[model samples]
Structures are given as C-alpha cells and as structure tokens.
Target chain A: MKFTILGTGSATPITERRPSAALLDLGNESILLDCGEGTQFQMLKYKVRFSRIKYILITHLHGDHFFGLIALLNTLNNTGRTEPLVLIGPHGLQDIIGVQLRYSLSFLNYTIDYRTTNPGAFEEVFSNEKISISTIPLKHRIPCTGYLISEKPALRKILAERLPPDFPLPYFKMLKEGLDVEHEGKIYANAEYTLAPASPKKVAYCSDTIFDLGIASYVYQADLLYHESTFTKELSARAQMTFHSTAEQAASIAKAAQVKQLIIGHFSSRYKDTSAFLTEAREIFQNTYLSEEGKTFRV
Target chain B: MKFTILGTGSATPITERRPSAALLDLGNESILLDCGEGTQFQMLKYKVRFSRIKYILITHLHGDHFFGLIALLNTLNNTGRTEPLVLIGPHGLQDIIGVQLRYSLSFLNYTIDYRTTNPGAFEEVFSNEKISISTIPLKHRIPCTGYLISEKPALRKILAERLPPDFPLPYFKMLKEGLDVEHEGKIYANAEYTLAPASPKKVAYCSDTIFDLGIASYVYQADLLYHESTFTKELSARAQMTFHSTAEQAASIAKAAQVKQLIIGHFSSRYKDTSAFLTEAREIFQNTYLSEEGKTFRV
Candidate 1:
C-alpha cells in the first residue's frame, strides 16, 4: 500500500501548504481522502492517476474538506468518466453536492454510489475483496470521522519448490487454501506444499479532531497512522478551544495506539516552518514523520 | 484601469489552461470578474493583492465560475479582513453560496452586500468614485451576464504653471470643475487654467455566450473587450450547440462594437495550442490580443 499526501495545510490556505487531501493507492484501485480546495490542481501537479480513484472518503462537512468535491466530480463528468464512483462521507454531503450540481446544470454520465457513514460509530463501512474500511469516531466541533483502511489477508502461498515438476494445476487451489490434496492417489500435505501469507496492512487517517486518548484502540497497531497536528504543545489551549490537536497530543495518541508509523499533518496557517512540530512529535513517538505535500509514504 | 487574466480555460480543467477568472484593478480598489475554481491559487500565482478586491462579479451559476469564491472569502476572513464585500451575480447565486457556507459551518467576520442582476436587460449594478459597473446581457445555456466596468471621468487638469504662485486653495475645486473664477476681482478664464479630462475608459467581459449581434451596442467603443472564444471557426457548429462563441464570432462582435482593443480567451480544453485562436481572431480584428494567464492589460 502507498499513501500520497496532496495537501498539508489546515482550513486556512497558504502557498507553502495546501489544505487536507491524500491518495491511498492499493494496486487494484485508489481512495481519495478529504478533498480540499485545489485538490485537483495538486493531483495534476503531483502527477497522480486521478482516473484510477474508485472511492472517495470525506471526514466531515468543513469547507476545507468538502469544497473541492463539486469541482472534481464535475471535471470527472466533463472528462467522460464512465466508471461508477463510490462516495462515502457524512450524512448531509450528498444533499450538498446535489444542490451544487443543480445550480451548475449538470448531469453526470457515470453513476455515483453515494454512501454515508455515522461519525459516531466504529463499525465496518465498506468492504471488497482487497480491503475493508471502518470508521473511527472522532471528537471535533462538528460530526467528524476518521478512516481505518485494512488490506484483506491474501491466500496462503504455494511452496512451489516442494511440489513435483509435473504437479497438476487443479490441486493448486487446495494447496493455497492450506489443505492437504490427494491427487492421482498421492497425498500432498498442506504444510509441505504451502507457506503462510504475510500480515495485512492497515492505514488510519484522522483530521480536525481534538485530543482524545480514549479512542486510541480504534487505530491500534495500524501499519500507518496519520493524525492532525494543528499546533505545537505551547498552544495546547488554543488547540483545545478550536477542536484541534497539538503535535504532542497527536504523538501521544500515536504512542498509545502503538502504530508502526505516524504521519502528522493539517498544520495551521500560522506556522511557516514545521520543524518544531516534528521535533516535538518525535519526542513522544519515535517513528514519527512529517507529512509534506507531494511526498509519498509506503506501507 | 488594469486587467489581469487569472484563468483562461472553459469548464474543463487542464494543466495548460485554467477556468474562467480575471481581475480588473482601478487603482483605489479592484473587481474580480467570474471567479472560477483555482482562482485563489491563480491570484497567488499572479501576485494579486486580493485584499483590495472590493467587488466580486460572477457571470453565472456554473461550478467553474463560482466554486473558488467560498475559499477566497474564507481565506480573507482568516486573514482578518473586516472590510465589507459587494457580491453581484445571478438571482440564485446568493442562496447557493449561502447553502454551501451553511453546510461548511462558516460565519464570516465581514458582511457581504449581495446584489442580483437581470440577464435580460442592461442596467447599472454598482457604482463608486473609481468606476461604474453595468450588466451586459448575453445569450447562453444558463442565465449569464457579462460586465461592463467603465472608469469614472477624471477631473479636468489644471494648468498650474499658468496660475500665480500664491493662488488661493479655495478656488481649486472650482477650477477643477472647469468654471471661470473671479479671484480678488481678477477674471480667470476656465479654459486658460483647465484642460478637458481624458475620456472615460470601459472594459467589456463576456463568457459562455453565443454569437449574438444584438449585444454589440452594449460594449460599443469599449477600451478593451474580453469575449470568450471557446472554439475555432471550424467548430462553429459545436460552439453554437454549446451556446459558446468561436474566435471568428468573437472577432466579429469586437469589430461590430468598434472596441479599441479586443482580448479573447476561455479556450476549449480540446486545443492545447492557442495560436490558432489568435490567428483566426486577428483575421477579422487586427487589434485582438490573446488573454494569457498572469498577463496584465492596462487601459
């Protein structure tokens, strides 16, 4: 799994940092997370294959998170995209898009499978053969939710070296299923012909949320965890009042979750240099990385 | 008056060309004409002093023409802009932005004085000391209105060298008004001290419109006329079907209106090279110029 950061700025717009947006590419398809204004332009600048995006997941109804949706969707329509797009967001997102499109005098050729996830729940919201998605309830001024995208476990691999040179292809499925296969009156043991698959990967994304230690279990042991660090610890009071998290608080959440790696972004516009956030976050979470625009992180 | 081209593409978003947007600066304040998506980024890219923008005029309800407005206004608010803004557009534009802002949970620090225009009639919508703005009715798929920003006539120039060194200041206003003054029982001819002011300059902007000859009178003798050339003459049929104007048609309108200079833009995304548009437009009007991004035209 590969994660690309499109925008790193918070609600405010700055030239150095864009608003919140990211792309998660998982081989089969990609997912767009929290499209802010200028997301399309950033996607073009970063040379992302935006056409491969099959699902779009939005966290909340904030302008920074949802303003770019109409533009992207309309551009997609104008560009003649026929593949169905699945859009999952808060409850009122569909109606808002409907109104904007109505005013735009538009009719899309591709069908939009609009779905809404309860920001107050932590249940699985989407599932496919390659991955499963669940919501992480977040504490924000508005109804906000993070996403936990977990790659589905692959089938057991066949130890081809152990198999005979002329092994029948029909028995490969049984061996991959970790079962013994008796083909042509000969027994093939599961352990001798098969090996266990690697562990599945999980990426958790959180933005525009206040410091909440109680929800650490929602992102426990994720392969990669991206949390908002809107301010430094010195401005912890301001962060709390604005329903945002400081770098130290995000690092604390990462440490409590015990994730493999932590990426912090959604920086406030007041900060010109982000080195302080990195230094402070790394003090608590040793495996912390700063999310920069156009940078890609691998899991 | 100085005009800066912000975006030049049609509805479709492309790398080489952006959507429709422009800035008209009249020294004291500026006016934004038809803000499209990524307009704020273009403003930043072109180094526009956005704080001085006092009036925002939108042509229609198309997403490309209106999506970036919310982001711009929000950025202004975040940057502590307390000066009120005047927004003039179609009838439903205010409610559309209102719905978007309501969903975004936004409360602006400054007030927005909203006004609507009739796309079927020509009338003045805004007037200030610097300029007067009128709506130019255009034929389009949607109810769209172009803008005619006319610079206010300057005060008559005083030949200060012809006056006495100790001339009283009380008569300056009268001299500027071009009235013969009697100072200390001495006759001072208005013609001897004052010269006629330069004629007022006017700029006409039309986008997403068809080739309508009836509207030529509205932009008659404009200093600069910017009209959309969405297609070449070869695709005049397609342009007619889409309710857009071709380069030749725009040139025809410019020639018919007797405008001083014509600027054509809003090229269709199908063509990457825009020299063809310039070549065809110049065939009919020799004084035509291509509206390129970041380029400024002064009148």
Candidate 2:
C-alpha cells in the first residue's frame, strides 16, 4: 500500500502549506481522505487519476476537511465520468453538497453513495473482498471520526517451480486454500506445495482531535498511523483549548498504540518551520516522520 | 482602476489553467469577481490584501464561478476579521453559503450582507462613494448576470500654483467643487482655478454566457471588457450548443459595444495553446488581449 499527503495545514490559510487531504492507494483500489480546499488541484499536481478514486472518507465538515468535495464532484461531472463514487463522512455533509448542487442546477453524471458516520463509537463502515474499513471515534470540538483501513491477507502462493508437471488446476485452488489434496492415492501436503500468505496491513488516520487515550486502542498495532500535531509543546494549552493535539501528545499516543510508524501533520499556521514538530515527536516515537505534501509513504 | 485576472479556464478542469476569478482595485476599495475554486490560494499568490476586499460579485452559481466563496469566507473568519462583507450574486448564493456555514456549526466573525441580482434586466446592485456597480444580464444555461463597475469621477483638481496667495479656506473647498470665487468685485473664473475632473473609468465582465447582442448596450463604452471566449470560430457550433461563446463572437460583441479594449478568457480545456484565441479575437477587435492568470490590466 502507498499513502500520499496532499495537504498538511489546518483551518487557517497558510501560503506554504495547503489544507488537510491525503491519498491512499491499496493496489486495486484508491481512497481519498479529508478532501480540503484546493484538493482537486493538488490531485492534478500529483497526477492522481481522478476516475480511479472509488471511495472518499471525510473526518468532519470543517472547511479544512471537506470543502473541496463539491468542486471535485463538479469536475468529475464535467469530465463525463460514469462510475459511481462512494462518500463516507459525518452527518450534514450530504446537505451541504446537496444545497450547492441544487442551486447550481447541476446533476452528477455518475452516481454518488453517501454514508453518514456515527460519532462517539467505533463501528465498521465499509467492507469489500480486499479490504475492510472502520471508524476510530475521536474527540473534537465537532463530531469527527478517523478511519482505519486494513488490507485482507491474500491467498497463499503456490510453489509453481516445485509442482509436478501437469498439476491439476483443481488441486492448485485447493493448495492456495492451504488444504492437503490426495490425487491418485498420492498425498500432496499443503505446506510443501504453497508458501505462507503475507500478513494483513493496517493504516489509521487521526486528525483534528485532542489527545484522547481511548483512541490508542482502536489504532493499536497499526502498520502506519497519521495523527494531527497542530501545535508544539509550547502551545499545549492552546492546543487543548482548540481540541487539537501537540507533537508530544501525538507521539505519546503513537508510542502507547505501538504503531510501527507515525506520521504527524495538520500543522498550525503559526509555525513557519515544522522541523521542531519532527524533533519533538521523535523523542517519544523513534519511527516518527513529518507529513510533507506530495510525499508518498509506503506501508 | 486596476484589474487582476486570477483564473481564465472554464468549467472544465485544466492542469495548465485555473477557473474564472478576477480582482478589481478601485483605488480606496477593491472588489473580487467570480471567485472560482482555488481563488484563496491565488489571492495569496498574488499578495491581494484580503482586508481591502469589501465587495464580491459572483456572475453565476456555476461551480467554476463561485465555488471558492465559502472557503474564502471561512478563512476570513479564521483570521479574525471583524469587517462586514458584501456579497452580490444570484438568488441562491446566500442559501448555498448559509447551509455550508450552518452544517460546519461556524459563524462568521464578520457580518455578510447578500445582494441578489435580477436577471434579464440591467439594474444597479451596489453603490458607494468610491464606485457604483450594476448588472449586465447575460444569456447562459443558468440564471447569470455580468458586472459593470464604474469608479465615481474624482473632484476637480485645483490649480494651487495659480491660486491667489492666502485664498480663503472656505473658498478652497468651493474651488475644488468647480465654483469660482468673487473677491472685492473681481471675478475669478472657475475654469482658471480648477481643471475638469477626469472621466469615470468603467469595466465590464461577462463570463459563462452565450453570444447575446442584447448585452451590448449595458456594457457599451466600457474602458475594458472581459468576455468569455470558450472556443474559436472553428468550434462555434459546439460553443453555441454549450451556451458558450466563440472568440470571434466575443470580439463582435466588443466591437458592437464600442469598448475601448477587449479581453477574451474562460478558454475551453480542449485548447492547449491559447494563442489561437487571441489571434481569432484580434481579427475583429484590434485592441483585444487574452486574459492571463496573475496579469493585471489598467483602465
């Protein structure tokens, strides 16, 4: 899996950084998270295939998180797209987009399936054969929920080179399912015929939230975790008051959750240079990295 | 008056060009016209003083014309602006922005006064000491209206060097208002003491519209006229079907209106190089120029 950071700034307009948005590519499918203002242009700049985006997960209704959605949908209609798009976000997002479309007298060329997320509890929101998605309820001034995306383990790979010549195709399926097969009184052990499957990979995204210990368990053992570090330790009081987390607080959560890697972003506009955030987060979580726009991280 | 072109592309998303938006600086006051998506960033790139913008005129409710408005207003609120903002647009704009704000549970730090424009008729929409703005009804798929901004004529310039020594302070104000002073039975001619005030400069903007000669009289004699030319003569049929205008058609309107200069923009995304649009427009109007992003035109 690959993850790309499209924006890192919070609500305030910052010239150096854009608002919050991220792209996750899970091989056969792609998901967009938190499409903030100017996100379509960011997608254009990053050369993301607009039509390939099958799902969009919005954390909240703040302008910094979901303002670009309507415009993106308009562009999709203008481009003559016919595929259905799925939108998962908090309540009121549908109304916001609906009002704009109603005013403009525009109808989408493609169908949109909107799913409103519930706050204050964890629940599975979406699932497919390849992946499953659930909510990580977060504490924010408004109703917000983070997303947890996990790729299901693939079937075991058959050792083709070691297989006997003219191996039956039916037996190949049985071996991929880790089942021993007896053909013509000859027993072929599943372990000898197939290699073990790779483990499932999970990624968690937490943003626009305060430092809540309850979130750690929901994202525990995630292969990758993206958390908002809007402020530094010096502004911890302000961060707490604004329902945002500081770098130290994000690192503490990352350490407690035992995440393999942590990426901190959603920086405040007051910060001119973000090296300090990295320096602070690295103190507690050695695998921490600062989220940079247009930079992709491998999971 | 100074006019800045922030974006020039039409409804389609083009990687090389942005959607429609423009900034007009009328000396003491500034007005933003047609704030398309990504306009806030364009303002930041152009170093436009957000505080100086007291008025915003939206041509239509199309996504390409006014999608960035809500985000811009949100950013203004986040920046702690306390000045009232005036928004002039179609009937549904207020509700569109109002719904988004309500859903986000955000209230503006500054008050917004919405003015709805009347379609199919010319009417004055805004007037202040510095300038007066009116609507030029245009033909589009949606209910759209163009804008005509005219800077009020300045006070007559007094010939201070030619004035009599120790001129009465009260008479100075009269001289500035084009009145002569009679001192001790000697008549002082007003023309000798003051120069005539410069003519008020006018600019007209018409975008996302079809070729309609009825709009010519409303924008007649404008110092600068910005018209959408989404296609060339070769694709006039397509332009007509799409409710857009060809470059040659826009030039015809400029010539018919006797405008001093014509700027053709809102080019279709199909055309990669825009030199053809300028070439086509200048064939009928010699003073024609293509509207370029970030470029400023003086009137």
Candidate 3:
C-alpha cells in the first residue's frame, strides 16, 4: 500500500500552505482521509484518480478536516461517477452533505453509504476480503477518530520448482492450504512444495489528536505510521491548549509504539521554514520523515 | 481596475485544469466572479490578498460557479477576517452558505451580506465613491447576470512646481477638486495649476452567457470586456446545447460593443491547447486575448 500526503497545514491560513488532505492507494482501490478545503486541487496536483476513491474517512466535523467534501461530491456527480462510495464519519455528516445538496439542487448519481464513527470506544469500522480497518479513539475539541488499516495476510507462496511441471491448478490450491495433495494418484507433501506467507503489513494514521499514551497500544508495531505534529517542543504549551501534538510528542508516540517508520505533518503556519520540525522529531524517533505535499511513501 | 483569470476549465474534471473563477481587483476592493471548487488555492497561486476581497458576484448556482464559497468563508473566518463581505448571487445562495456553516459549527467572525440577482433588466447593485456597478441581464441555462463596472472619473493632477514649497496638505484636496486656491490674497486659478483628469475606465464581465445582442448596449464602448468562450465556432452547436458561447460568439459581442480590448476564457476541457480560442476570437475582434491563469489585464 502507498500513502500520499496532499496537504499538511493546520488551523491557520497561509499562502504557501494548503489545508489537510491525504490519499491512500491500495492497488485497485483508493481511500481519502480528512479532506480539508482546496483538497480537489490537491488531488489534481497529486494526480489522484478521483473516480477510484471508493472510501472516504473524515476525522471530524471541523472545517479544516471535512470542508472539501461537498465540492468533491459535486464534481464526482458532474463527472458521471456511478461507483458506490462509503463515507465513515460522525453522526451529523450526512445531514451536512444532504442540506448542501438540497440547496444546490444536487442529486448525485452514485450511492453514498455513511457509517457513523463511535466516539467513545475503538471499534472495527470497515472490513473486506483483503483488508480490515478499525478506529483509534482520539482526543480532540470535537468527536474524532484515527484509522488503523491492516492488510489481510497473504497466501503462502508455492515452491514451483519442487512441484511437477504439469501440476493441476486445483491441487496447487490444496498445497497452499497446507494439505497433502494427491494429484493423478501421486502424493505431494505440502511442506516440500509450499513456503510460508509473508507478514501482513500494517499502516496507522493518527492526526488531530493530543499526546496520549492510550493511542500507543492501538498503533503498536505498525509498519508505517502517520502522526500529526502541529507544533515544535517550544510550543508544547500552545499545542496542549489547542488539543494538538508537538513534533516531540508525536515522535515519542511512534517510539513507544515501535513503529518501523513515522511520517509527521499538520504543521502550524507560524513557522515558514519546517526544518525545525524534522530536527525535533528525529531526536525521539530516528526513522521519522516530514510529510510533503504530493510525496508518496510505501508501507 | 484589473482582472485576473484564475481558472477556466468547464464541468468535467480535468487533471491539469481547474473550473471557472476570476479575480477582479477594483482599486481598493477585490471582487470575485464565479468561484468554483479550488478558488482559495487559485487566490493563493495568483497572490491575491484574501482579506481585501470585499465583494463576490456569482453568475449562477452551478457547481462550477459557486461551490467554493463555503470553504472560502471558513478560511476567511479562521484567518481572523472581520470585514463585512457582500455576496450577490441567486436566491438560494444564502441557504447554501448557512447550512454548511451550521454543520461545520463555524460561526464566522465576519458578516456576509447576501444579495439576490434579478434577471432581464439592468439594475444598479453596488455604488461607492470610486465606482458604481450595475448588473446586465443575460441569457443562460440559469438565472445569470453580467456585471458592468464604471470607475469614477480620475482626479486632476496638481502641479507640484506651481505650488509653494510650504503649502498645507488640506489645499491639495481642493486643488484636485478643481478649486482655485487663494493664499494671502493671491488667487491661484485651478486650470492654470492642475492638469485635466484622466478619462473614466469601464469594464464589463460577461460570464456563462449565450450570444445575445441585448448585452451589447449595456457594455457599449467599454474599455475592457471579458466574455466566456466555452467552445470554438466548429462546436457552436455544442455550445448552444450547453448554454455556452463560442470564441467567435464572444468576439462578436465584444466587436458589437466596440470594446477596446477583449478577454475570452471559460474554455471547454476538450481542447488541450488554448491557442485556437485566441486565434478564433482574434479573427472577429482585432484586440482579443486569451484569459490565462495568473495573468493580469489592466483596464
């Protein structure tokens, strides 16, 4: 899976920075997270295929988190999109989208299924054959939840050289299932022909949250982790006052979780230069990266 | 007064292009016309001072025309803008803005005074000391109105050499107003001391309208004119079906109005290049230019 950061700016407005938005590409399917204002342009800038965005997860109702939704939906409708979209957010999201559509006389051609997030507890919100996703309860000014996506374990790979050249496809399935295959009256041992599957990859996205130890357990041992670092250590007091995390705080969470790599963003607009953010994060988590717009990272 | 074309793409979403939005800088005021999805980013790209945008005139309720208003308002509020903004558009515009603001839980620090547009006859909508604006009714798929802005006549230039070195600043205003200055019983005639004022400049913005002769009279002899050319002459039939205008049609209107210069944009995304649009427009209107993004045209 690959993750793309569309924007990384926080509450304050600056000419050089755009609001928050991110894209997660999982082969054929794409997911959008926290579409802030001007996200459509960010999508264009990043060459994201809007038509392939089957799932959209909104962290909260704040304008900086979900304001781009209506415009994106309108564009999808106008462009003749027919795919069904799954929207996961707080309870009032549907009402917000519905009222705007009503006033604009917009009747979308696609189906939008809204799934309400549970504010009180962490819960599994979405699951498919290839992936399972759960919510990580996050502390914020409003009801919010971060997402944890775990890719389903891959099937064991076949030792093709050890198998008969003309092995039937049906027998190969039995071998992958760790069973002895009897094909054409020939017994084939499963262990001799199959190798163990690779480990499942885990990606966790945590943003718009204060520094809390409770989140470390949910995002533990993640292959890749994205955490919001809205301020530097110098502004830790301001970060607490605003219910946001500093670079040091986010890096500490990643270190506690033992994440392989951490991507930090959602920077406050006060600092025109962001080198200080990376320097501060690296002190706590060595495998840390600063999120840049349109840059993609593999998990 | 100056106008900048921020975006010109049409209904369908294009990866490299953006939807319709323009910035009209009228001396002390910044007026936006037809703000689509990513107008805020476009404003940033064009270095427009968001705080100075006091007025917004929307041609219609189409998604590509006004979808960005809510986000723009949210950003302005978050940026701590307290200036009252005037929005002139269709009847339902206020509700569209109100619902989004309500759902997002954003109470803007600034006040937005919404005004409704009436089709068919020219009506004066905005008037200040420096400029007066009137709406010119036009034909479109929806209730659309063009805008005609006439800047106040320029003040006479005072000759510094003709005035005493120690002359008070208050008399400069009188000199600019064409008044004779009597200092210590010496009468200074206004005509002998000051040069004649420059001619008043007029700009007519005709957007999302079909080819109609009625608009020519309202925009007669304008210093500059901006007309939407969504198609070329070859696709005139398609333009009519979409209630849009061809480059030739836009030029015809500009030629009929005897406008000094013509700017044509709102090109359909089907054409990868815009040279054809300018070429077609120039055939009919000698002083026609294509409206390019971030490029400013003086009137």
Q: Write the per-residue lDDT of candidate 3 for residues B87-159, one digit (tens) a residue.
A: 8887778877776676556698989888788867699888888888789898887778888888888789999
Better of 1 and 3 by DockQ: 1
Better of 1 and 3 by TM-score: 1
Q: Higher TM-score: candidate 2 or 3?
A: 2
lDDT of 1 by residue, A209-245 (tens): 9999966799999999999999999999999999999
Q: Is 1 or 2 the stronger prediction by TM-score? A: 2
Model 1: which residue pairs collide? none
Model 1 residue B181 lDDT? 91
Per-model DockQ: 0.59, 0.72, 0.41
**Which predicted model would earn the best lDDT?**
2
Error of 1 at B131 (Å): 2.6
Model 2 DockQ class: medium
- The lDDT for every candidate, in the order shown, is 0.90, 0.91, 0.86
A209-273 in candidate 3: lDDT tens per residue?
A: 98897888999999988999999999999999989999999999999999999999999989888
- lDDT measured at residue A171 in model 2 versus the true structure, 0 to 100: 93
Candidate 2 achieves a global lDDT of 0.91
Tens digits of per-residue lDDT for model 1, B212-281? 9876899999999999999999999999999999999999999999999999999988998999999999
